[model samples]
Target: MSANKKKNLNSMEEDPTADDSDSSSEDDDDDEPHPDAYTGNEEVEIDFEGRAPTDPDCHGISQLLQRVFLRAPINTMQMADMIIAQNYVGSVICQCEPDGAESDMDDDMVEEGTIFGITTVINMTAKKDIACIEQLRGYIIQRAEKNAPDSVLTHLRDVLGNEGRPVGFLINERFINIPAQISVPLLENLHKEVLTAKQKGMQFNFSYFIMIVKFYRKEARKGKPAEDTYTNAEEEVICSKAVNSFEYSVADECDVGMSGDWLEGDATLTPYRKIILLDAKDLPHLIDDIRNYISGV
Candidate 1:
């Protein structure tokens, strides 16, 4: 390659899809301004540090990867290593690369005049975890940048040690499946824990609240006293009533489970309650209305 060719290659590698627009808007490029400076309409990049294992990092990049890992046919561990090696952390952009045969060049762009494979630009860091994030970030940025420069861009600080699902729980608490009959008390306990975490400025990722109830009838015992037999109709009636009443106070049930009662004992009911899983966007509202949630929000 001639000296000019070598210089051009280096430049293309530096920024294969660099925009050279002369727009005066700071949002057009990678410049930070005062929080209030930019209008909300303009494209901007923001970073967030979430508190829950499921809370998406920044632009849901990590969460997207997690979903991909779960469904991907390839080895997750190897993919993680590849991502890290490519320094694919932070905001990633995915966009088309142009071919060299095309002589037409957008003079305003700093990109190479040639087309290539899709470009993924990383922040380029020594830390494997950080690099992984940057690689993703670059991939996302490129995709978004393919359109107008103002289309999309996002980023997040590194947290994962290795690529897998983020490993953190709300206040580091484990979730348990219990009967809905005790949801009130359990919710109250969660309210307390959440309130304390909020006071200390902590973050967590459990955001859903759920409840399920099953009813059964008691069968007559030959050796033992007859357990009261609650009929299936009676069980259904009770479960339906409970669900209807709970919806008024708590979130509407996204799903519900029901089962016939086991023979023996007075008709019996078991309610499985799961707190609604929340997203990062919903955390503040949850923290503020935790009392309402406990009481019947």
Candidate 2:
């Protein structure tokens, strides 16, 4: 209500539990940033874009929301919408009316947990039915800004099928299923077809699951990593090896009714089809998988 309070409420706070819900907008005085999001930070006013700036200090805002989205009892569609609305397509963003009372702010943030918003950001445009899940993922890895040292991100265009269990991209020319009932041609089309309007553009970037195999260093087998020795692991090698052992690309696994055996039977003609334009960088890993599968390796 008062200009002084409004200014304080709009600024991000230090606790990391500040609320941002406009549910109380009907109550004139209830509109303001959660103390956690506005405290101990710059005293700048809200930007034209409601979201926080993409600054080093404010990087945790998005990460906080991402944690809430992922852990809350919500669906992917809801998560997508919330993220898009909050980010406003490159627009700055801010929290809505605080989610709880001043006294309860700490509890709310504790429930939501601490946020690390400076994840890699992505921009993509799909066409027809392009396979992008892989590309989305590659971009996350390629653009990572955090020192996660343990995770990678991936993104892709919308490519839904009759089911939505294992999300994938149109990376391979075919699909591969464990039991092998999905269709190769249809999956190919799914990979190629852009369900969302490529006219404007559609893309989602999320962290990829990490798969690591540990080998005790010849010296580490004797003790904890030497205090002065910098710990290191070859990510590229790990990425390459983990992929090499896979039997199919996201394309092949996601294709309608593709099966490892079915693809093999059609080897006389190479059923593979490049229905979608793929990120050249992620191709080698994909190619190696298909080649190995074909060789029954």
Candidate 3:
């Protein structure tokens, strides 16, 4: 993996929730200078590096995981530890600081760096013995049985219950405002890493992949029907490539604490979780579709 790759931010979107009042300008005489005259935007460059999650990254990794499993009784810290311990198949995204910025600090004393995103796969069949993994497996099954269609339920049981068919839970998580473009490189690298692990005789060989995707349905208004929006839009592209997928509302199951600004308004939105199953052989195609969708190709 490249240790210090740089990406231009010109194509990235600004935070939608950011306060625009600071940039607002008052009208001025044609000849006089306006205090907040609009200036041309400059292209910003950011350096992002991918590295194996380590002991020091648990806190940062867990924080990101918490957002995904909100109100669910999963132990995110243990899950983070498992990701770090696996070490061979996943990556955590971190910003690359300038050289020598922390030269004075001892190596051990270096701060737990910020984590921008994480992508990894957990072998559900192999890791069933783990407490957190078991908890998650049971949670998914319970939710599906309660909310998903019979077809989805039967498919999940056939795959998860059969020891010969290993299922991988793919986790793609990040902060709310991160652009979909960052996901392209992260997912591509994850595919390469998993293949390399399989070649090393690791237990990464799998029959199917299960992904829990986050999305919200915007309430209908003015005679228009409700609309659903994917929080990470690129995942929608992956869903298009899936063999089977189903969505269920989590609004009743989630705690009040899970509600955010998006849920508050006259035309309120409802949050839903979509479960998608894809053949392992089709992962490459899904990744390619995500790349194309994000690039507007």
Candidate 4:
């Protein structure tokens, strides 16, 4: 992890900043939120009235809400207004619905590496409590460490999984590797725990992930030709609801989301949005475009 890049995935910091590369763990002790930040108690708290969303397979909450809002026969401004009134921030809510329903499918991605996706953003609230933000951060850290025989992870996944609340994670690609047998017991443990959290009116998070995959090359046939190529022979257990449809076992390389942080923001004058259902890497450049548009440059 470059000490300089202090955003999600690479960010171990509670706050994201331009000069965060030099920051040490001790630096987060301050009570200050960032200059462009707005923090608040963010939740969707859907009663569901014994009904899931029209499309429940979609794993991202922000994505789910956006779709529901858009499909409700309301204008953009009206839908935006509803989102703000609900105190909604970015979150990935995992839900498994009965078959044949409108799908709320956010993208499902898997990769092999120590690096993965996680993000940090500033909240915009006048009455926002910084302590709440700090407390939230502490809670997340504690969540990750609750599991014992903790994998290569220095932190436990529980502290990070906090009810599917979109949290952030810091991944040092250099921090992950496997020499002995790779038994994904931790991921299996996480899948079960996520269901329990939802039963009690909570959401499971999908922000930070630590992905490590091992691969081997073999021979195979494609239609008429036979070829021996690389394949993944290991079975990776994942939280089914955390993501959409996925294969139970693959042999080439195994990638699973690791631990991380969720972002909460405020929108009083303008509408606030986080967890846009779009991948962070995709949106960053667009955000740059928006900034340029805002400046009339």
Estimated TM-score for each candidate: 0.19, 0.21, 0.80, 0.18
Number of the top TM-score candidate: 3
Clashes of each: 56, 42, 0, 40
The global C-alpha lDDT for each of the candidates, from Candidate 1 onward, is 0.25, 0.26, 0.71, 0.23
* Candidate 4: residue 204 lDDT (0-100): 34
* Clashing pairs for predicted structure model 3, backbone only: none
Q: Report the lDDT tens digits of candidate 2 across residue range 1-297.
A: 112111111232232222343222223223122332233333322211122233332323433332222222223243233334423222222233443464354444322322212111222222113233333344333323232222221222222221232222221111111111111222222222222222335553311222212111122235654221101112223234332111111223222122111222222222211112233234345444544443466
In order of lDDT, best first, we have 3, 2, 1, 4
- Give the per-residue lDDT digits (tens) of candidate 1, residues 1-297: 111111111111111112343213333233211122222333322211111111122222322233222221323243334333432111122112334663343322323221111111121222335544444334323433443233112212222222332322121110011112222222333444445544765432222211122222233456764332222122232333221211111112111111111121112322222111123334344433533433464
What are the per-residue Cα lDDT tens digits for candidate 3 across 1-297? Answer: 344333322122344534434432222222112112221242223355667777888887786676566778998899999999987778887656657665332233223376666789999899989999888888788888888789988988888898798899899976444578878777877898899999999989989998888888887899999897787879888888778778877667544333221232223778888888889888888888887887789
Assess candidate 4 and give its lDDT: 0.23
Q: For residue 143, give model 4's deviation from the true position in Å.
A: 34
Ranking by TM-score: 3, 2, 1, 4
Residue range with the least summed lDDT across 10 consecutive positions in model 4: 171-180
Q: Give the TM-score comparing model 4 with the true structure, all chains together.
A: 0.18
Question: What is the Cα-based lDDT of residue 154 in candidate 4?
Answer: 37
Assess the local accuracy of residue 141 in candidate 4 as a C-alpha lDDT between 0 and 100: 33
The candidate with the higher TM-score, 2 or 4, is: 2
**Counting only residues 3 or more apart in sequence or on different chains, how many pairs clash (N, Cα, C under 3 Å) in candidate 1?**
56
Cα-based lDDT at residue 184, candidate 4: 20
